[model samples]
Target: MGIVDSKGHLYLKEDPEVWIKNNPASRLALVTSFRLNLENGVEEIAESIGELTHLIHLVFRWCRSLKRVPNAITRLHKLEHLLFHSCSRLEELPANIGNLVSLTHLQLSHCEDIKFLPNSIVNLSKLTSLTLCHCVSLVELPANIGQLASLTHLKLSSCRNIKSLLMSVANLPNLTSLSLSSLSLSEIPYNLGDLKKSLTRLDLSYCNNIEFLPNNIANLSNLTSLSLICCNSLIELPSNLGQLKSLSYLELYYCNKIKSLPDSIKDLCSLDTLIINCCDSLTHLPINLNVLHLKLLNFCPRFLPNGLINLKYLRVNICSCSDESFVNWKDPYSLQHLAISSCFSHCNYILKVPASLNQFVNLQVLSLHYKKRFVELPANLVGLAHLCLLDIQHSSISCLPWSITKLRRLRHLMLPKDFRLETLSYELNISVIISVNERHVRKTWEELKTEIGQLPIPFGGEITNDAAQNPSIMSHPGYLWLKENPSQWIINNRNLLKLVRFLDLEYVELTDSIMQFSELTHLCLDIAADICLPDNYFVTFTRLTHLSLHFFSVGKHKSITHSLSKLSNLQTLHLHMHHSVLLANFNMPVSLKYLSLSYCNNMRPLYDSLEKLTNLKTLDLYSCV
Candidate 1:
């Protein structure tokens, strides 16, 4: 007995001669954990799995289609990990869950439909991690939940509906990490008399309506990190916080109401990191603050606190008085990282960075963003040989000077999109420009890559490496290294030819594909408004398997029919059209497994003909007009 295809396909008729029978764990146990199945279309679990009590892990994460766990699951005494994360349809946990006291990890993240936890959960004293992240539908926790004294970690991030903790959390003496973002508690209870002594990290950010911290927070003493980044209404801190000798980090950015720091703070000489931003109205720092060697400092640059003398790093986007640099450092100290984000619009100052930075020979990273009409790199920048990243983005300057070539050690040089370079290596490829996120920025850079690759702007397209030879694209770090070498374009095509396993040609304007990327397995061509598959366009791409077409051809009623019968390995097809028709009958082969057509206007005939695809297992028709 096991689950398959949204039902319990009971293997009740197994031949008696068969000695080796399959079990629940036999269903792909290679993965340690898989969560979020909200769209799997599974309506229920079959009762057959009740007999597979030996299974140690059961995860039905985000199973929005399943309203309940099979009743037979309670017999799984060997279960060690259970996760039903984001299971919005799950309204309750099996009451017999208590019978499996061997459970050590439980996660019910984003289970918005659950109203309560089974009281039996109290029996899991061996639990190590419990997460109730975003359980917005939950109203209460089982009163006995706190009985699990062995609990070491608990997170209740975004449980907005919860009004109170079960009070049992205090009993879990070994608990170390706790996050209670957006809790509804009016006040933290002082009933513990002491904070959880073993607790090391605490996050109470965004609990805005709460007025006070428990007085016992200091007694725990072992706490190392505290985050209150957006507790805007917090007016006071418990005196106990000052005595936490182990605390290393404290954050209070946007807590605007508080104006002063407690004298108890002087006891935290061991503090290495502190952030107090957006407390715009209050000013001045305690004289004893000079003893701190803070690693980072963030605040309105115009209203810098006076006593931050040994600050190691500063991120100030304020306008400094004409040619003036603040003196909050002891001739450099640990000031190795600095970011001055904004330049004054009105003042025409000396435009000199502080002279003290000369003592900071160790400065390795500097970023100046969104500057006014400033031009040219600062003279001090060229000397910092150790500097690895320099970003002067969104500046009024239009071009970088030849002095930039001296930054031999620099790895990432970021500037505004309009900035241009003249005499740089012709072999440079924009693909080397790394992006923090894979979105429009990536496409913009890729478009630039294809642009820069096609014709090295301002330089002749004479690739030393002939395209006839295939070379490994990954061996070369910088495309510029291939200059004056004939084997360059060969390497370029080798790099781009089959390198893109996932193709995202959203708005590519090529009238015809010029090259064959035989290894391209997945293609996304949404927003390709006027693109039409060329005749015999994909004939050479034998490995093309998955294709997706979406949005951008609005009201055009474009006819898009193609012969992909050669794609014998095709597995999935996804289409999203505003108005289009199959120009010709699809020559889909037998390997196709999934097909989805979305937002297709006048698509009834196309689906009616899809019945010919007998091998198709999954068909999705959504938003089709």
Candidate 2:
């Protein structure tokens, strides 16, 4: 009954009964869903699809060679979902596709050659979601697009040729979410305010030509989130924007022409988060801007205004202008996360953080990004006892405050790449992680234990050996086991360590206990000095395919090199020693398929040793000075 390959041809003589195997009595009854995966040489599906009388869903995703959808598909009276995702060669849909009155979802993402949609598409009364993302050649939508009365979400992002939308779109009564990112739209219909009753989210990011929002946009009382990122031509927001009572999030990044915000913004009582970045012309903010109980806010302006009394998360980038107004720490204490970035491009200066920072008794995370500023942190940090994460980078500070050792609740300490502090109080046994990027960081085993503690386990919220039966136990990068001070929960569940596949260690000594992790495949080590590994260190690491070594000295060169040679299954190796005098020679396993030696300044090309790695497919030697 299953047709595997047709080679762009259809055989109508095949019995329809083969497609349905459950019953001989219903041989002619078409199934509710028909999913076809065309073979390598199959380029087309013939018009026989019309014979599927009961078909409600037809999905042909990953059919890269398909050039067109058969017009006969319109014959399906019950078809509700038709997806052609990644049909790269598809040029167009049938002009009369709207005949499928029952269709509710249609996705044609990544159809590179599609240029237009049939105007009749607006006739699909029940259509709820329409996605045409990354359709490079799509120039526009039908002028009567608002006729899709039931449409709730319409995504036309990455359709670069779309210059404008028809004003009729404003008439859709049920549209809730619309994304027009990465388009050439110059302006949206002023009547978009008509959707105020139902529209909740609107994204117009990367619409570079948009100059201004319609003043009538304030009528969207139900709107919650709005994004206008990278709209370079945007100059200002509607004066009555504060009238949107339900608005929770408003993001406007890189809109350089905006100069000021309306003082009426204080009327937005429900506003919880607002982000405005890279608006070079912006000099000031509303006088009473902080009246709302905002949970998260990211703003960059010359002079910051005062009343932020209830912020839980805040990121402030100070422009060239000096910091004048001091922050107001809410009395009932709600602030938890705070980050400050200096935007002084012309010169390096020391920024003085107000001592009032200690007022946030409930503060948890504090991050600082200084281009060239030496910020004098608060002398007394014991008041911020709840703080857990402290991140500092690209700053010129002489040393960390001695009070840092007193923060017992602190779990993660991220320092700059060139950070020089070598010792820390062993009593403050938190994990010292090196920030790698936004998504991933270098974490130590002790930090890894904290990560495991955060997981939601079933038995008393502890990760027990029997807890492994629950599939969600080891679902995330942070939900892994490591050798830290063995808690009673871990002591009762020694087998739980076998579930860990990734291990990141900082300044940890190599020991024989590591070989017990039979499933560990990824390992990262940050060594400050020498490490002598056991003779058969990697013999049991048969599954370890990725190894990263960030060393500061060549003291363990022979020991480390000998240990690496035993990793016979290792296919990827990353060396991140930046100092010049480190080991210039390496004896790597021939099984390595990817090798990266970044920031090894004095490393010279070893042609002979490299030639021995015949299986290597990628070699990155970035910044080898």
Candidate 3:
């Protein structure tokens, strides 16, 4: 069962005679539970897996050409799980591997030339999770390694030249989680807290000259996650660092002479995520970091801890504090999410706007990236009517006011990235440009030549029906949706009067205003060559439910999914064509849950008709050849 194509990509081939005629000890008994992986391709199953020893997991991991492992697997004593992860040309191991004493789980991670191990593997004795991570030419072990006392999770991370990690393997008292990261070793063997009642999680990051840390590490206290990152000459913390009271994550990054911390660090009040990046001699923080109930607070500013007062997700990334020190609103009001980089990058020499920023009234999203020159906003930024999402990426913004089209509960207004608009208007404020120049500025120099210079640049960005029939904008609603989506005349004319429910003409090549939508529910037309679908093209789309047509070419519906199955509550469907244009020969409609087909390269293998849809959860077949 293999090679599935049409862009989804699947391979799976090999079949040594259907696994040697369905596992033959020469007999027949079949019911699922079968397993045999000769690790990698080719090797044609070592002369038929030595005749399938009642296989229940026999993986000759990466069996690279001939070389042993076939002492016929010591006659499989009902093998359980012997995975040789990374058989780096596996050098040795078939010393009858203790005859698979019903092996529980033994994975030789990295299996590099198998340096040594096999004191008959302590006769497995029903092994419980033993993985030699990176086995790295494995230096030494098996001093009865405490005889694996039913070990529980012992991962020796990057065990290179281990040096001497054998303190009799910590006497394995049912070990629970132990990792001596990059064991370059410099000393930690102080009876590592005697595995304090089964340690929880501890990683000695970059063990470099350890420098001291194990007075029984305050007796583990069921340690709840601790990493002394880059232990660079580690210098502090051990006045019983608050005795681990179930320490909720503590990562001391790049310990550069470790300045200070540990006024008993407020006894770990369930600390969330705290990444101390670039410790740069980390200056003081933690006067209990504003009552430390943090949910992800990444650090950089040489350690920020000034009255964080429980900062509610604020990323002031490296401060220089100058939008008058962020409007000086001190209360932080559990700030929802604010990103203030290097203090408003000279935001147009801000003269005002910090009317205490309405005390961040649970602000939703505000992004301002201004390097300087001019960006002073918020003159009653409409008192932030619960601002939805305004991203002013790098600013010098020329204009945007008409009370920003009266917020009307604004959803998303993201302009600023090359947002060079010469115009977008509703008589643009300044008191509507001084009341249209005190009434037409004395009979017009082209009537105050504004109105987006008489708008019109293809696809619904219209505005010039003699400037929307300007007898003072005869009830201008984009000049009645530009005479209701009709085209080709003056520069533009959008006369749809208010009611713009949802319209997104993606790659606007213009022309084909779908009868200019009468309260369009959702329409996104892309790469337009020519389009116009609303000659009642399927019952006036009674509140259409998302339709996106890409790479178009109209007037030839070889039967577009049987005419889009007549929209019957269409959820979301996007079709893209070109390359091998065929308006028909298709199958869709299970009331699409979300479908995407792009660049019809040659459209064949539709995954067996897209697995009968079944209210699909999402399917994207891009560049479909």
Candidate 4:
């Protein structure tokens, strides 16, 4: 019986014995926003909820048999947002709760039986966002919490019996985001540089007994994000930390007794993202870091900061390096995304693919992970040419270089998901091909139309249908043919197709050359048999937006779920069905925002079409039964 609307909002999830039997002056005093969730047998909350009195947003979520919180809610004097998140058997919080006075946002996170806080909550005074994250029996705080005075965001992460902090929190002065992550602090408040002019985000991540750091913390200077993730007794880091200068993100993960980095950090210069993962005794890296996104995991830095040159995203993991460690790795040349993993699992390492990687002539994403002695790949990798995404995972690279079809802006080719191709370099004119050996596993649609009429045709002569209806030869910008007779070169180069991935082939009938590309935007198909795709077969691509379908059975497909709800610029949808499939009129695409379903079965008639997606933001379910 709670649903008020018309400006005076009010929402309450049933069961507090039916809204405490209503009648709070009938219209609940025009509640100005009040939300209450009663998780099962609610334990308490009805002081007639202070008769609403135009409550300015008050939420008590997941009551979990709530236990106390009714000091008549501090008499809601125009309360400005007070939340008891999770309410895990809430234990405290109403010692006058600062007498409301228009309190400005306060959330008791997880409230694990909160232990301390009501020191009159420092008289709120327009409190500006205070969240006690995971208050695990929170102990100590409120040593006059710096008299609140418009406190600006403070979240005591994980609380963990908070060990030290209250030096009156450097007298707040509008603290700008401070989270003592997973505290049990072993040192920090030496007046914390008195919140150097309103700190701008500082999270001592998982403070594993913080080792060193108070060199006035480089006097903040408007700190812009600094997180010492997994502190691990952080060895050192205050060597004037380049005096912050509006630092822009720095995360030293798993600290590991530091070991070096303070060469004044080459004067940060507004450093833009630097994460050194698992800092295994860091070993050098401060030669002139004009950082622009750099990540190194499991550490490895005998040398590689020849003045980065405004590096643009570089990631290296599980280092073992030694081809002269990238021969002094010099001049990043504005690297555009590069990732390397398992650098070379030692043991007489023989990986070799770094001929200085052609000096990144504007590389655009190249990732090679778990290189189990990576076998091969450098046929000058087609001289970069703005390479557009090439990923080789769990590699032992088995044949792929027919000069990789001379790249020419290759659009996404990710191989090695246990890839098993024994051959296919017959001057490969690639489109999307995956052959799972075992003598062509299962290809019988007339041997897949006689192997698509013996493939191989990109840029290899042939013109006349009046030069393919010349509009300057169909908007020339050649070089994207993807093979001979590939459905007549994909219907005369349908606007130079954009991204198509087909894996585990077999019985693949290209669907009229995939509806004539028409500016296709990423499509992946993995069908291994039981076809069924004709409900207007994707209704003319329509600028398709990322779709992946992998089905082995689903035989009598129900019009492909009504043509995936008439994709209106579909945004990422992946469906994998094998055998048991009854999407029961699935119907997705409310302009989907990433939806993944695997091995779906009954799924209770797809639960009201997944509640009409409502612009779904990631909903992944596997082995759905």
lDDT of each: 0.58, 0.67, 0.54, 0.69
| 10 residues in a row with least lDDT, candidate 4 | 474-483
List model 3 lDDT by residue over 1-625, tens digit each.
Answer: 2322343222223433454565444331221123233435443334443454554454544444323456565566666666766666566676757777777777777776677776777667677777777778878777787677776766776667776677766677777777777767878778777777777787888777777786677787777788877878877767666777776677776777667766766665555545454444656566545343332122333344545555555544333333454443354565555654433333335422334555666666666554443343543456555656655555544234434545444455455422212233433322222111111111121232331132222345533335454322212223222222234422233443333433444454455445555655445555445544433353455555556666555344344445665666565666766654543345665666766666665455456566766876656565666
Model 4 gets an lDDT of 0.69
lDDT of 4 by residue, 124-186 (tens): 788899888888898888678888878899888888888888788888898898988988989
| Candidate 1 Cα outliers beyond 4 Å, as residue runs | 1-44, 191-193, 287-298, 302-310, 320-331, 343-362, 370-389, 393-625
Q: List the candidate numbers ranked by TM-score, top first.
A: 2, 1, 4, 3
Which pairs of residues collide in candidate 2? 1-18
Residue-level error in angstroms, candidate 3, position 96 = 32
Best by lDDT: 4
Model 3 ranges off by over 4 Å? 1-133, 136-179, 182-187, 190-263, 266-273, 276-306, 309-581, 584-625
Q: Which lDDT tens digits does candidate 1 get at residues 56-92?
A: 6777755667788766777767778888766777788
What is the C-alpha lDDT profile of model 2 across 1-625, one tens digit per residue?
2532333212222223344343342433535666765644556666766777677777876777877777888999898998987878888889999999899999988989898899889889999999988999988888789889999998888998888888888888899998889898888888989998999999999999999888888999899999988899988888898998998888778888888877778778777887877666776777555433331222443355656565677676543443442343224277788777665352365665555667778889888776457434665677778888887765544235546767778877776543322222233445554343321336663543332222112223334224654322322322332324223333555666665555555565555666555667766666656565555456577877777777866454555655776788787777777564434455778887777675665454445478788788766665666
RMSD of each: 16.4, 16.0, 19.0, 18.3
- TM-score against native, each model: 0.57, 0.61, 0.30, 0.32
Which 10 successive residues of model 2 have the least lDDT summed?
Answer: 451-460
Better of 1 and 2 by TM-score: 2
Q: What C-alpha lDDT, on a 0 to 100 scale, does residue 320 get in candidate 4?
A: 47
